[model samples]
Target: MSSIHPLSMASPYIRIAHDFHTEENMRIGPTRIVDHALHYFKEGDGVYTVGNRPTTIKAGSLFLIRPGVPFSFSASPGTRFHMYNLHFDLIEQEDSAAITFPYPKQGEPQRVPLPCCLPDEQEMPVSGLPSSVPLVETATYEQLFFRILQRFGQPNTIALLQSKSAMLELLALLLRQTENQHASSTSDGTYETHLSHAVAFIQSRLHEPISLDDIAKAAQMSKSYLLKCFRNIYRLSPIKFVMKQRIERAKCELLYTSKPIKTIAGETGFDSIHSFYHTFQREVGTSPGAYRALAHSTALQQEEPE
Candidate 1:
């Protein structure tokens, strides 16, 4: 699993939430869903079919089904099953809570959601998230699932808010798992050597226009492979990584030097003063001059004896 930075969105609006303890010989749809869904198998002996892919359900199998995907559930011969099922919208709409989906139908066509990704300005390079995550410690996840189910099974505003908060926490936990996996992958000697080379190249070229090709060449890999490496390790593209390095260098120059804003901008490889100001404001939440002034004020206050 690759690392994924929390992308732009508020807490999800949960639509349907339930804990299902199945009866004997049970089988359910080939249902096409219109909202995102999470089916956490707490203790199940079953097979979950999503699109054309099918996976066996274990004690801690989590199926993350995006909107418009066809899925079905079947019990493993004579075995009863138990799962926590949740349907939600990635972002809330005014009428989200009022909407309800139709019953599952067979042979429902699949519909794809707009791609979710990081690197705000870039086109979506990430195609799809993992369909299933086999959880290691089931207790923590069970607690979250219980909280979400409990909160959403209410009739008040506070309950709604609490459910949404718990949903976000669950998503964060899943992302942290993937991030830890990616971190371990990066610890491999070859990946570390290439990543170090790539970082050194970016550090050296913070004052020059560094391109994706340049970074790939430095890392001795193809551009596509380099992108995969960066996405896995840093959860962003190589060019975005370079831009970040440039901004960091600019911040250091602003705080410690008397250079003019334009000089600093040019030295940090920004195309123009306007571009520098825009990127600086977006990344640092302040204009270059304002940040420098604030840093200067802090330094002066610190230098004064208490």
Candidate 2:
């Protein structure tokens, strides 16, 4: 009937680290959000508050505010400027800096600054970005922040994929933020590097018969560990991700080509036409022939509709 937030996903919407949001403020003073927020002001002046405490935001100011912490903002009377606001999640406060907030729990927003690792209810001004980030490019994060805010969420059939894509983009933005802000601490570095190897390893041989052992070897990880990593970081096992990718490719081929199902199966890497059919039905909830027909009908309906 309607759409739901993707964050409530059973295994965490993002497979890897906790997700976050980024926004470039055109003007946020007139409204409020009921989620945790990390505001990095790039330009102009605005007044913001958490509960009853007031915080002044301007270019080069950053603060982490948690959900239910009442906050409001107002642009300086004559300022023609905007600020980038980012809301992010992490594994732990120890994994980040003393200023980072790991609240929000995936779907809530704390718009007021909360003390990192502190049990206090009062607000405070903190300095420094997360360990994974650097300084000086904080402004660049403003642009990325806007992009994150733009894609937050709503409802759709593709809600899962859409939220995932948004998270991936947000990850890139955060990494860039770390770089730009010159974070005092360095990121693990290999989290993405090894992850890239894993994906490329899978992609390079998708058409052949392969096993978890082979894939893990290519990615330099143990099979068991890789499965956990894949599930945690991608919200899927390696095999599942491969299947999903193959199915997406198969959908394109089915709609755009006149090839036979057996041939398509071979091209997409199934051991037999039987396996292809089963996987397609399970993931897509429709057989290949049925899907093709439906896709064709939908296309024709669109072409002829008022």
- lDDT tens readout by residue for model 1, 219-260: 998999889878876677989878876786777677657999
TM-score of 1: 0.51
For model 2, residues 1-306, the per-residue Cα lDDT tens digits are 844322223121321221222233434432343333555655666666655656665555555454344456656665644445454432222323333443434565553443222112122112222311222224234433432443344234344344445444544544444332232222975555565577766655667876788778887877887887777655688888787767866776786679998898988889999999999999989999998898667545444424
> What's model 1's lDDT at 70?
77
Off by over 4 Å in 2: 1-186
lDDT of 1: 0.71
User: lDDT value for candidate 2?
Assistant: 0.53
Candidate 1's clash total is 0
Best by TM-score: 1
lDDT of each: 0.71, 0.53
TM-score of each: 0.51, 0.42
